[model samples]
Target: MLYWLIKHVLLGPVLRIFFRPEIEGKENIPAEGGVLLASNHLAVSDSFFLPLMVPRRVTFPAKIEYFTEPGIKGRLKKAFFTGVGQIPIDRSGASAAQAALDTGVRLLREGNLMGIYPEGTRSPDGRLYRGKTGIARIALQAGVPVVPIAMFGTDKANPIGSKMWRPTKIRIKVGEPLDFSRYSGLDGDRFIERSITDEIMYALMELSGQEYVDMYAAKAKEQAQPLPDRLPESRAS
Candidate 1:
């Protein structure tokens, strides 16, 4: 398969040789069975590097656009992502949240590991943001343990808005699996979901040592951008 070829034969060796990626607490990841890997969103490379360093294949639900773009480049891009274990999910409409849960639950129920970014988007300034509760819901619904992970130096290796990769070393720290079975049958409770999500985020904050922001990453990005200048009223006369 292309995934095996690229990881073992093509790209994996090249990356290990240059970047020297390191991982701590690798043993925390179970050798088998289903798990939900909840990590902070840093650079786009977080998706690539985290999976690259882990022994087990980690699959994330990527935006549907990654596989739907037109033209040759798009096709190749889609192929590469799919080969790398990215699944496409439609992130539109009112049911997008449920749709994502369905996709993740199916994978977990089938005894597969699933990677998720609870922030829903990349952090704008490397500060940890409030985690979305969808991940919590998925874990509860699937009865899987949530493994909190934190990736460092990935932003420097493949920074935001950069089209090329750098040689910065990447490090990953994995926390012990969090079991929320005590809150069983409470998947539909928003309060329980929020508590679970906050607990996972706290674990990530401890691992990554990043400043915690209570707002969503997308909202923080919007707040960081300057607003457009407004025209003075011309009809005052």
Candidate 2:
């Protein structure tokens, strides 16, 4: 279908030829069954490149805004995400977070590879951030293993404000799947969830060699805002 055509024929070929993305530990991904690909979010291209490299169709819960914007560009974006099987979740309201996790659990139970960023958002400074527990909740709910993946050089190719991708070498490292089968049926336990999330973040830190920031990426970005304005004072101007 459209996913196959885009990944294999249209976009895949172009990316392979130019970026020449490399992957390590490909064998770590389970050959079949419901599993979680827990990865560190480095850049927007992390989504594109990971799916292209993996054999299976990886589905991500895209923010509802991506599918609801106005104008022709918005229409195309919606169509592309829908055609490729992305699930749109409204990332607003108190119930939105649970709804997204519910969708992921259902997908995993259906034996689909669900791509999740445990950190919740892209790393603002390329350092691994403390992971949110939604990933752990989904994994425990679905009774699946969590595979840690590290993406390298994507931030350079698709930096924060770049509209176009540059030719930068890309590399992916997949770590062994972390099994929390012993914690089965304990999905809602906050302590267990935090423990599981921290373990996943540690694996990503080891794989990516990025500094592990104790704070969440979103908070770090917020704090980073004031530094820019303070830079002038530090420079004595």
Candidate 3:
């Protein structure tokens, strides 16, 4: 009920009036099914714009921090995410990763559309990064089709760490469904998982036209970090 009210009666109408997102390849989305929407994460707005444009209710696993913040502000944030159909989960370490995967699989088994960022994190430089294999595991475990989606120009609308969103034009390019039925019951194969993940990343690269980086987005961000300042050298020491 909250999701419906927010998407249809409240925020959706306001966002559409301003952003006016252009959605292409709407035909690619299945009318009804347990499916995976694997997308390239570019900006914070990707979550909002993608859900707003899609006819079906899209759910993503958001960081538990969004739901656990303190005070009135935190309460509002939690309310908004819950209202928008997002599931809050821990995203810290290996165990958390597995937990998130389990959550996604359960959602799919229940016939819900699940949105995932295979890059594991947003592109630090607006380029596609190597995908994590969790998405493949979810698809294979749930026995669902993976639809590759590319969210364009969302970075311009809401750049990384930007609190305010601009009314910028954006496009959503949806690719055809990728079926991995043959890989069903083979989720334990790491090699097959990598193959599937790479294929999905390639589709995203083609759709978004972003340069592909072979490193994980989070690792790339770590590599791009600036080195700490060096202390001034003592004269003739």
Candidate 1 residues 13-102, lDDT tens each? 888887899999989998889999999888888888888888998899999999999999999999999988899988898698689889
Cα lDDT tens digits for candidate 2, 47-130: 899999988889988889889989999999998887666879988877998889889999999999989898889999888899
Q: Of 1 and 3, which scores higher on lDDT?
A: 3
Relative to the true structure, candidate 1 has a C-alpha RMSD (angstroms) of 1.0
Top candidate, metric TM-score: 1
Which prediction has more favorable TM-score, 2 or 3?
Answer: 3
Would you estimate the TM-scores of all the predictions? 0.97, 0.93, 0.96
In candidate 1, which residue pairs clash? none
Ranking by lDDT: 3, 1, 2
Off by over 4 Å in 1: none
Candidate 1 global lDDT = 0.91
How far out, in Å, is residue 209 in model 2?
0.9
Predictions: Cα RMSD each: 1.0, 4.2, 1.6
**Residue 103 CA displacement from its true place in model 3, Å:** 0.5
- Model 2 spans with C-alpha error above 4 angstroms: 227-237
